[model samples]
Target: MKFIAEIDVMPLKEILDPQGKAVKLGLGNLGIQSVEDVRVGRHIQLHLEAADEASAKSIVEEACKQLLVNRIVESYTYYLAEFVLSN
Candidate 1:
């Protein structure tokens, strides 16, 4: 079976997001005052083969913990689904 994982990685809430702040400041300079407290993060999509949903989920979770996210400074969340043929 094939599975798809949609993942989100983000800086920890306690960690300051300098990039987000810079973008927010830039937006303010552009007269976009409505936007504030902006935060930046990454999205990742993965397709892989697995025996079942449980196996797929375990693989994705391990990947996130071991490689995708920095446990100390960043966190990750993911959604997994079985791949289906539309045609």
Candidate 2:
């Protein structure tokens, strides 16, 4: 079976996101004042072959823990779905 994983990784709330803050400041300078408290994060999409949905999820989780996310300062979330082929 084939599965698709959509993952999001973000800095911990306790961690300061300088890039996000800089972007917010830039936005304010550009007259986009309504957008505040901006946060920047990473989005990843993966397609893989797995035996089942459970297996796919486990793979994705392990990937996040081992490589995709920094446990000390970042957190991650992901969703896995079976891939369907269209004729």
Candidate 3:
């Protein structure tokens, strides 16, 4: 079976996001305002071949906890779905 995973990696709420701040500030310069506490994150799409959805979810979770996220400063969320043929 094949599965698809969508992962989001972002800094913890207590952490500051310089890039997001910069973008927010820049936006103000462009006449956009009323925005506060902006945050930036990464999105990852993965495809895997596994025996079942549970196995695929475990593998993806391990990958995120061990490599994709910095555990201490960042956090991650993921969703898994069975791959389906369009035809």
lDDT top scorer: 1
Candidate-wise lDDT, in order: 0.93, 0.92, 0.90
- Model 1 lDDT tens row, 32-86: 9998599899999999999999999999998999889998999888899999978
Give candidate 3 regions above 4 Å deviation. none
**What C-alpha RMSD separates each model from the true structure?**
1.0, 0.8, 1.1
Q: Model 2, residue 83: what's the lDDT? A: 95
Model 2, CA-based lDDT: 0.92
Q: lDDT tens digits, residues 1-87, model 2?
A: 999999999999999999899999999999999996988999999999999988888899989998999999999888889999987
Candidate whose TM-score is highest: 2
**lDDT (Cα) of model 1:** 0.93
Model 1 poorest ten-residue lDDT run: 35-44
TM-score of each: 0.93, 0.95, 0.92
Q: How far is candidate 1 from the true structure (C-alpha RMSD, Å)?
A: 1.0
Question: Arrange candidates by TM-score, highest first: which order?
Answer: 2, 1, 3
> Which window of ten consecutive residues has the lowest lDDT sum in model 3?
30-39
